[model samples]
Target: MRRLLSTTLGQILAIIGCSSVATFLLFIVLLSYFGSPPAPPWPWQNAYRVAGLVESLRGAPQDVRNTIVAAVRRPDLSVRLTSSPSACSRQTLDTHDFDAALRAELPGITDLAVRACTSHKPGETIQVLVPLDGQTLEILTDRTSGEPGRFTGPFYSALIFLCVGVAAMSAWAISRVIRPLRQLSEQADAFGREMSIAPIEEHGPLEVRRAAHAFNLMQERIMHSVQNRTRMLAAISHDLRTPLTRMRLHIETHRTDIVPDKLIQNIDIMQSMITSALAFLASDTDRETREWLDLGALISTLCDEYAEGGAAIRYDGPEQIRFFCRPEAIRRVLTNLVDNALHFGRTVTVSAKVLDGAIQVDVSDDGPGIPEDRLRDVIEPFVRLDHARNDRPGSMGLGLSIVKEIVQAHNGTLRLINRHPSGLTARVSFS
Candidate 1:
């Protein structure tokens, strides 16, 4: 219920309802103050006039009564001599206004009363009583002479139509505002999944357009920075390769007895590191197009390749599960995570499953897991925990870093957690 009220539709409805009620009440107050200019005299005024005429004719002769009755009688109104009071019920009468008007118009008359009663027709009729010297005179008037204490049918119908029209207009204006915000949110989500998404259209109200414009500018700046960094890395790689090549040629020319094997191995390691660094940096300069692929099959293929190489790698997942992603990038990420697991553990397990609208892939190993404190630090580029953990040859520590970047590019998350009793588990999840 709270969430429902917080929505845009709920707020708009609340505003419309409150405003309509307030405006209706304000209109009633104004009408009462100024009064209905076009409306005829109220029921009380008509009753008072008839009562005054009757009071003046009190104690007059029968001839005088007949003459006055003939003058005052009409199709909708009549005055008559009666020995009993009016038969109409007093419950529905507006006695306050009726008695006040009667007192103002005929101060000498007392024991006055007024009532509204149903007639043979569809509408109500007013009954006014005035006591004479020894008899009671009755006055009956048309329905229009009494106020019903409620708005007329037409008035209520018009009020309803006004409220509905105003509500529709409010909904339209609110939708216009909310539509742009919804578009902006969708664009942001797309950019998170793929940085190459087109810029958001600068439209709608001023605030929305300004936000879109700012987002586009920020995206351009980030792309520019990435491009600049990739170019610098490429230049550095080219400049260093020439000197390394020269040193290699010079070593080959020297005698083997003087130049140790370990020294040559060191130079080869440096070349391999340079190559890996260049590859990693170059990946940032290119955009990978995403496509739907079988994620389970990809993981199974990686497991098969490793098994063929005599590694204890097993896959536990469905036969095929399709997902949209950059195939090559995801493949590289899975390969690196599997290789890293194999390096520390004798047995490596790769598994995939769909959970909560997302795809989760887990790579687990039976080796000693990384320390809890160093879990976050190990994913940083060139970060090595060789001093604390087993030192593997030719490991530059770029594997996990690359995996993190690829997973993030797909709007996914990667987490490394120590397994119970022993080993480590690396889990990646993406929607």
Candidate 2:
């Protein structure tokens, strides 16, 4: 049952079954309390039976009437013939809603007398009465069942056949609907753990086919982006190396302390760029296992380390905020955000806390923040804002992209917002 309920077809069938039972119960309630009892078997079966007996006994001789009663009586049914009045024995005060139904069945008859009366034996009953030519016929029958006569053999058969037909149609329709979604989910799971995957087939309803098509396009775009980025990195590596080679050759020919110090700074910048580029292409953070860590302390220690290195960085918020994520990946994200902060701003403030049922960490900097228009673009790969702010060495524009990828892998979001006057806040939030 548990396995059955897990599927869409089973759930729908369960609902139908429950609804059928509810409807049946409602019918029983209406018949028992609020309305009249159901007609027995057919609409006018009892009336017709009594009418047949009346027709046979009309103006018959006394001996003939007795013969007919003996011939027609059943084990549960009895018939009586009399020309006497007051034939009913101890009539009870039961409601007579069925009297109108009896009259309606036999249009030829204008009036009929009927009553409920006690029986000699426990199962005997007063079925009904018939009036004939100067005679009365009383029908007494044994009660067939102690329970209410609500269902018949044909009714049960119909209900079973109806349920089977409905279940078959529902299972077919639901299976057709669930098939594509299940395939899409399986493909997604495989792709997240894999880089190269064949495109998923687009089939099903319009929305499902469209979603599959969009996913295929996204995979192609990502594959293209990776190839383009690798080519760009190779070109950049050669271009930057030519100048460094010449600068080294110059230093060898004419050595000066000042020249070498400035040149070394440029060399450091070049190395930073190369390292960041290679790391971005490798995306090693994707393979890390997730674990719970004290994010608050991690930010605090990172701020103190930067502060010791003469950068104006501070940490705030709680002492411990346990968050589930890849520690190294989160550290990489923090490293990139903080690097951008120190390069552009004079001071950096790193804070972490639980906000709105999510783990939120904000790295704010009082630097010349990114232009409002370019905030979104800065997060994309290889985007540099040279015109918006002063040129920072080794700013290859891959840091935020790496950060975004790592955050997304953890099912988190990275949002860059410019401060009011002159700063930016990088907010990382996840539940």
Candidate 3:
């Protein structure tokens, strides 16, 4: 019940039910207070008329009684003088508006009876008795057949139609309000997953339209900020390259005698680091279009290339599995992970498998894995483990960072885990 009330349809239905009931109750109150506009004269009114006419004949001459009987009598309504009162005494009459009207119109009369009865001649009739000069006067008229009150048929149909129309209009308006919000939520998620998502359409109620417009502005600003940062980094990397090249030439021409071989190696490593950093920054700005590609084949080809280069690498998993992604970005991610594994460990094993509607690619190596505490830290730029600080040459510690960036750009996750018993595992998963 609680869950039902949470939905739009449920709330609308509840409103319709409550409003309809309230409206009906209001109509009932109005009817009770004002009553139905004067209907045809009631049976009791006819009976009262007969009583008034009969009283006129009381103690009158016989000729006057005969004349009134003839004047007031008709086929559907009749006035008669009878000797017996047994017919009116047999049945009890239900009190209604007619009874009240009769009492108000005939206040002085003491003995009177009004009842409904069926007779063979008339089928149904109202019998009235009035005491007239010691003789019981009987006035019988055709009973008024109850024509069901006005609040029926078209009246109820119109009410139902009105309620239905109100509910329908309310639902449409609510949906119009909710649809844009739902679209905004979807666009927000898409923006998080892919930076290139289009802006939300600004159309709804005033507040919702304002919110959408604000969201679009925020997205534009974020993209602009990232692009500006990337451009600045690229320019700095390019400027540093010219000086580094001139320094290399100077060292070769004159400083060779004084500079140790390690000094030259350090210069080379710095150049490599500069190149890698430039590449890292440039990758973000790459307008690489995405397409469906066979992920298994991509991993297999990477492993094969490493094997051709005499690296101890092995490939595992299905032969082919197509997935939508940026191919170059994914290739770079896989290449970085594979190169890192080969550098740190003796042998590398690349594998891919489908799990829970996503593709999971695992690159495992028989190397000393990162400590649990440092696993997250290692993925940040320029973060190197204590062991790799001196031993690994030309290592700027940006390989895993680049890998993480690319994976996240594809809306995927990259994590480094220590394998059971031995070795480190780099797991990249994408849906």
All models: lDDT?
0.75, 0.75, 0.74
After superposing all C-alphas onto the true structure, candidate 3 shows an RMSD in angstroms of 14.4
Q: Candidate 1, residues 117-173: lDDT per residue as tens digits?
A: 675343336677777766777777655544544567788778777877888888888
TM-score, cand. 2: 0.50
Give the better candidate number (2 or 3) by TM-score: 2
Candidate 2 pairs with clashing backbones: 345-367
| Candidate 2 lDDT tens digits, 1-431 | 99999877679878877776776667556645524433554324555666677777775676788898878887666787767644454442221433444666656777577665564565345456667666667776543433344366776677667766776777788789778888888988888888689999999999989989998898888877777587557657754875588677767878685677768777887887888778877877758888899888988888888999999998989989888889998988999899988988899898888877699889999877888888899888877788877866666778898999999888999999889888999999887
Query: TM-score for each prediction?
Result: 0.44, 0.50, 0.44
Stretches off by above 4 angstroms in model 1 are: 1-264, 284-286, 391-394
List all candidate RMSDs to the true structure.
Answer: 14.6, 13.2, 14.4
Clashes of 3: 0
Candidate 2: regions farther than 4 A off: 1-218, 227-231, 234-242, 245-253, 256-263
Residues 1-431, candidate 3, lDDT per residue (tens digit)? 88978976678768877887788778766655433223455545564676567567875786677687778776766666667666644442232444444555666776677666655367336666777666676666665656326576888788778877887887788888878988998999999989988889999999999999999999997986677466546545654565467667767777766556645665777777677777776766248888999989988988999999999999999989898888888888888899888988889999889987899999999887777888898887666787633345556567887888788888889988998767899999887
Considering summed lDDT, which 10 consecutive residues are worst modelled in model 3?
Answer: 89-98
Model 1: colliding residue pairs: 43-145
Counted clashes in each candidate structure: 1, 1, 0
